[model samples]
Target: MHTHGTETPVNAPSAEIPMTAHKTQAPTTDRSAELFEQAREVLAGGVSRNTLLRAPHPIYAERASGCRIVDVDGVERIDFANNMAALIHGHSHPAVTAAVTAQLEHGTAYTMATRAEIDYALQLRRRAPGFEKMRFMNSGTEAVMAAMKASRAYTGRHKIAKVEGTYHGGYDYAEVSQAPAPHNWGPAERPASVPLAKGTPESVLQEVVVLPYNDPEAAVAVLNEHRGEIACVVLDLMPHRLGLIPAKDAYVVALRDWTREDGALLVLDEVITFRTEVGGMQTRYGVSPDLTAMGKVIGGGLPVGALAGRAEVMEVFSAGAGGPRLPQSGTFSANPLTITAGAAAMKLYDAEAVARMNRLGTLARARIEEAIAVAGAPASVTGAGSMFRIHMKAEAPTDYRSSYPSAEEKALLSHFVDGLYDHGVMAIHTGAGALSTPMDEAVIDQLADAVLASLRKL
Candidate 1:
C-alpha cells in the first residue's frame, strides 16, 4: 500500500519487507482482548480516538509512575510514549501533585476571574520573553484553533500556510499532511490541503495552504504566491509526525523574515515541545514568531493549552477592542488547579535541570543510533536537546515527505513494534515518540539493547 506521497516508516525495512511472524502461543493479551471486545459493543472502534487504537488490543492501563505504565493485564512496561509526549515529568510527579492539591481546594474553574490565572500567565512570561501576553485554553487543539482564528483577526487574512508532515492538534486547517496518503495531500512543492479526518468542513480546507517544511525556497515561493490572502504561517517548532525533524535554524529564520516583510504573521505550535527550555526552541534558534500555541507540560500533567504572542498582536483580546471581539472562552481556561500546578512544573525546570534532561536525551539518541549501526540497520535519529526520535531511515528526514510510514511499511512495522514491545520499550505505533527526565543511563542502555535485539529479528 505504499504510495509516492507517503513517507518511509520509522521501523519498516528499506525493501522486500518480510511477512509478519505467525501467532506464537496465541500471543498474551487475552484479558486486554476481552476488554477491547466489550468496548466495541459500546465505544466506537473500541477506543475514544484514532491515536489510542493499536494492534491486537489496546492495553487498558491501570496506573503509571515515573517512566513506567502498568497495564490492566499486569504488564509493567517502560512508557516512552509518555502520553504522546505530554508528561514531561513522567507520571504523578510529587511537586506537581503538591501544587495541584492546594489549588484544588480553592477551585477548579470560575468563569469570572482568579489570581492563579494571572500567576500562570506571569510565570510563562518569565520563562518566555516572546510571551508578552497569553490567553489560556483547555487543550493544545483548542489553543491552536484559537491561534488560527486570532491570526485571521489580527492580519485581516483568511488563509493559513502550514508545513507538510507536522501535526498541530489536528485542527481542520492544520491537519492536511499529518500521517496521510499523498493522494489526499496533493503535490510536492505546491501542496493542496486535503482534510485528515472526515468531520472537517470543506470551508476549513479553503483557508489552509500546505508548505514544504525545510524547503526555504518553496516556503518563500508559497508565501509570495499566497501573499495578501494568507493570514498566518503555522508551524510546529519541532516536527512531530515522523522523525522529530527539528526545523533547521536558518530555514526558520527565513520564514520569520519573509512573513514579517510580507505583513503576514508566523505562528509557532510549541505544544509538545515547550518544556525543553525556558523560552522553548524559539529562544534557542533566535527566531521569534508572531504568535505561539503552547500546551503539554505547561499545565504540569493536566490538560492545558495557551496562545502566546506579542502584546501588539494580542491586544485584540483586551476588554474592548474595535471590531467584533473574537470570544476566547473555555470552561477550564486558566483554572486555579492547573495554573498552580503548571507554575510549579515550569519553575522546577531550571536551566541546570533542563541541561541534565537534554544530556540524557542526547546520550539516549547516540546510544540508540550506535545500536542501529551495530545491528547493521540503515537508521538515523533526529530532534533537539532532550527530545528526539529514532528514524529508521538512511538519514534524518529533512522534511515530512522523507519521514513516516507507507501503508505496507506500516504493516511491516506492526511486527517490528511487536518485537520492540516484547523487549520492554513502549512507544506509539505511529513510529514516533520522545524521551523524558526519568530515564537515565540504565534506561537508555535497556532501550538500546531492546532496539538492537529487535533489529536482529529483521
Candidate 2:
C-alpha cells in the first residue's frame, strides 16, 4: 500500500505509457465494499450524496491530505473533484486543519455571535467590494435561498429570473429549470419554468422566469414580459452543469441593465466560481451585482455559506430599526470552527496564490486541448480560472441547450471518467475539474496524459 507523502506509487501508471500498460483497477475493494454494504442498511442509497454513488458501489475514503485521497482499498489518487469544487486548498490542508482543531478545543457553536464572524466578514469585504455587508449561513443552498428571499423582500416582487440550466442550490425558485430537456423546455426565445422535482408546486414554477443562457436579446425580451414582477435575476458566471461555459459579457451587461430598468436586483451565485478569482469571477466581468451568494472554498472543507451585497439590500436581514423586513438566523451560522478554518484557508489563498493557481489552470486547459487534438477525438474544454470541463463534442458549447449531451455521449463521458479513475485520477463524473492550491504543472501534466489515454479508449 502507498503511504501519504510518496511522490508516486511504485507501480503507478506513467503519463508516458498507455493507461492499460499497468493494473487498470484498484487492487482491493473488499474493505470499501464491506463498509458500503453495511451503510446501505442505515444510510439512504448506501451514501449521503447521490454524487458519491458509482456503478458497483461507492468507494469509501480512508483518509486524505493535500491533493490526494486514499480509499479503503489503499488506492491513492490525485483528487481533482475536490469534493465537487468545495475544497479550495484540497483535503486536510494543514493551516485549515490546525485552525479548526484549535477552535474545536474552544467550542463549536453558540447563540451568541463570535468575534471570528466579524473578523472573517471584514476579510471578505476587503476582498470583494460587492460584499459591503454580509450574513453567514450553513450551506450554499441556504445562502442562495437567503439571497432570493432577500431579493423578493427588497423588491416586494413575486417573480424571480434565472438563467436556464444554471444550478443555484436546492431552493425551489433557484432550482427551477436547472435541467430542462428539449421536450419540456419551451423555446429558445423564452424558456418555460421547468420543475426539477416531482410535486414542485406549479405556483413556484410560475413565479420563476427562465432565461436562455448567453442570449442577451432573448433574456431581455423574457424579462420585459415579466417587467415589474421579477424581483431579481440570479446567475452563475460559469455554471458547472452547463458545460462550464462562461456567461458572455454582453449577456451579463444585458441582465444588469434590464434588472436596473425593471427595478429588480441582480444576484450573482459565486458558490462555485468564487475560487476563480480573488474577488470572485464577477470582478472579471466588470459588473457588481446587488447581492452575491458564496460558498464552497470559503468554508475551508467545512460546511459554510454567506450572502453579501449592497448594504441597503442586505438591510432587510438587519433588525436595528425594529424587526427587519427579513429575519435570518442559523444555529451554526458563523460558528467558530468554520470561521477559523475558512479564515486560515482564505488567508493562505492570497492574491499571489490565486494568480499562481490560475496560471496552472491555464496550463491544464492548454494541455487538455493538446491531448484532444492528438487523440483526434470529438472533445473540447471550457472554463476559466482554475476550473475546466471536458465536453464530448468537437466544438465548445455556446449555451445549455447546445451543451446538453445525447444519451450515447453521456455513456461515453461516464466511460471516459471511469477510465480516468482507473488511471489514478478521481474527476467529477461530469468530466469537470477544479484545480487546488497544492496542484502544480506535474499534476496538470498527469491529468492531461490521462485524458489522452482515456480519449484513445473512446
Candidate 3:
C-alpha cells in the first residue's frame, strides 16, 4: 500500500465506532424525491439504470460545468463519477459544446456518412495506432456485442473467455459470471459460468469460459482446455469492481501468446481505461489485442461506442468482403453531433493533459493512504492513472474474491460516501473516483481533505 512518499505508521488505536453513530439524516432532496416518485409510475424503479438507485433518492442533476455538478435541490459538489468516467474534459467544455452546437445547426443524422465521422475516426487511429479500422456504435455494450460477434466470425468458434467478476456490459455472454455468488463461482482455476440475471438462458451461459484475474497459470490452463472452442479472451486491463486492479504484465503477455497460438482473437475492452493515456492504456503494457472496444471519454459526454481492430479481422463488418459479412447498423451510430464532440474532447485530452491528470491521481492516492493510516481504518486504495477505488481492507486486493467487502465493511463505505457527499465532494458509492482534466492539484487536495474528514466521522 506504500507509495513513493513517506510512509505513515498505522499505529493508532482502532476506533470502536458504531455505523449508526455516523449515520446522520439524509440530505435535503424534496425535489429529487418528488421527481423519483413521479418517474417511478412510468420508469421502472424510478431510474433508467439500476446503478443510479441510491438510498433516500438519487440526486437529480440540474446542470454541470467543469468538474462540478448541481443537483435539482441546488446543491453543488465536485464530481468524481464523471458520468461513470466518460466526461474526461468534464461537462460542457467550450470546444466540445461549440462543436456539438454547430453540428446541431447542420443536422443530426442522415442516410450518408458525414466528413465528421471520417475525421473523428482518423483522429482516433492516429492517437491509438492499433486501430486500423473502426465502426461506431451507440454504447460500450453494443461495441462489446459487435466484438464478440466479429471474433466468432473470424475464428469460427462460439465460446468466449473473460475474467470472473469483471463487467464488460449488459450483453448476456459478456456479462456471464460478472458477479456470481461464492457458491456459484466454483474453483478459482476453473471458474463456473454463473448467469448474472435470472432469465439468462442456459445455452448462453455455456458459451462463456471464466478465468481468474492475475492468475496467469490458471488462466492459461483454462484456455488450453477450451482452446478449440474459444473464439476470444475478453478482458478489461483495469476491471472496475476489482478496484481497478491492473492486469499483470506477465498475465497479459500470457493471454496474448495463448490467443495467438490458439487462433483466438484477443479483445480488449478499453471503454473506461482509455483515459489512462493519450494512446490508450494498451500502449503502456506494450501488448496489442486483435479487437479493441472503446467508449466513455471517446464520446465526450455523449452516448457513443466503438469497435476497432486490424483491417483483416474488422473486414467481417464490410459487405464488400467475399465471405459472410456481419451486418452492423444503427440509427444514431456515428451521428455528426457525437463525432464532432468526441473529436473535440480527444483534441483537448492530449498527452500533456493525460500526464498531468495521472500525476494528480498519484497524489490523491497517496493522501488517501495517509488518511487511512491516521484513522487506523482497515482500508487500502487501488487504481492507476486517474481512476481509483478505496477497498475496505488492510491489504490491496488482486482478485474479485478478495475485493468483495463484508457487510460491516459495506456499511462503513456507505457512511463514508454519505459523508463525502455532505462535504461538497461526490464519489461513487462503491468507493471509486475518476479524475478529470478540469480538476487540478487544489481539487485533489480538497478531495483528500474530504476523505480525512469522512474517515474521522466513521
lDDT of all predictions:
0.75, 0.87, 0.86
**What tens digits encode model 1's per-residue C-alpha lDDT throughout 297-342?**
8888888899999998897677675654576777778878778878
For model 2, which pairs clash? none
**Candidate 3 whole-model C-alpha lDDT, 0 to 1:** 0.86
Write one digit per residue (lDDT tens) for candidate 3, span 312-402. 9999987774645688799999988788889988988888888878887898888889888888878899999998898878999889988
- The C-alpha RMSD in Å for every predicted model, in order, reads 8.3, 5.0, 7.1
Candidate 1 weakest ten by summed lDDT:
1-10
lDDT of 1 at 445: 74
What is the TM-score of candidate 1? 0.90
Error of 1 at 203 (Å): 3.4
Ranking by lDDT: 2, 3, 1
Enumerate residue pairs that collide in model 3: none
Best by TM-score: 2
Question: Poorest 10 consecutive residues of model 2 by lDDT?
Answer: 10-19
Better of 1 and 2 by lDDT: 2
Which has the greatest lDDT? Answer: 2
User: Model 1 residue 135 lDDT?
Assistant: 94
